[model samples]
Target: MKLFLIGYRGTGKTMIAKILATAWNCEWADSDGEIERRSGKSIAQIFSQDGEASFRKLEIEVVRDLATGPHKVVSLGGGAVMGTENRTTIAAQGLTCWLQATPATIAQRLEQDSATKSQRPDLTPLGGLEEIQTVLDQRFSVYQSCADFEFDTEGKSPNQVADEILVTVAKEQKMNS
Candidate 1:
């Protein structure tokens, strides 16, 4: 089964997906990493050189390729599902789960993770909590509208999120089985 993990910039989607994939014996696909690999540049460099529109086109291609492929857990970029076509493609073929975090929480996490921020094209623009809040306020409705399940993860760790996903996956498996 394919599951699409979506959330804001600093949410633990990647870490959780990696752990959950290991725990569940599933293949893991990180959309941003894939996009960077396919594009041959860091996302920050991509945004600097090619801009958001170009990066998003690459994001769309990565998402489409991933969402249509074999069953795997895919951690999507923050803006991946902004496009209706991307949302429709994911929703049509897989379950989309939203990992929710407050803008404060995201800023806190981002500030602590300089290495991650160095590679993240989207996070570099934000100065701090206020900037993050503004962006979150702008995009949150879209994130909510696209998700099939929403899980609040403000104070949670990677293991906690993975546990929650594992439980949900088990329940879904049982129901479907």
Candidate 2:
């Protein structure tokens, strides 16, 4: 079964996806990294040059390309779900795990990640708990709507979260079988 992990930024989707992929012995890919690799540009650069609309178009194409392959664990970029076609394709093609996290948890994680260093476009201007909450609020409904399973990783390690996902996937496989 294909496992697609989706959630807001800093929700541990990529790390947890890696752990889950290892457990499942499946390949893993980060949607953002795939986009960057395909376009020869970072996400920030894509946003600056082609704009979010164009970036989403490329993202949807990536999703289409990836969706055709075998069962694998995929980590999606935060805004990937905003595209109507991506959401529909994911809903039709895979089991989506929503790593539901409170904005505070998400904010702290983002701040602590060395690479991000608080460079998220939305948070750059009003960098604080409130801004993060606002952004999550805007995106929450769509993520929740698309998820087949939800895991709240408020204070858990990636290993623990992966275990939960593994167990859930095992049970789901059994049920489907």
Minimum summed lDDT over a 10-residue window in model 2 is located at 117-126
**Best-matching candidate per TM-score:** 2
Q: State TM-scores per candidate.
A: 0.92, 0.93
Shift of residue 30 alpha carbon in model 1, Å: 0.9
The total of clashing pairs for model 2 equals 0
Q: In terms of TM-score, how similar is model 1 to the real structure? A: 0.92
Clashes of each: 0, 0
lDDT of 2 by residue, 1-177 (tens): 688899988889999989988887889988988998999887877877788888889999998777768878889999899889999988888899999788888878878887674234553456668877777788889989989999999889999999999999889989999
**Lowest lDDT 10-residue stretch of candidate 1:** 117-126
TM-score (C-alpha) between model 2 and the true structure? 0.93
For residue 56, give model 1's deviation from the true position in Å.
0.8
Q: How much is 139 displaced in model 1, in angstroms? A: 1.5
For residue 118, what is the lDDT in candidate 1?
72
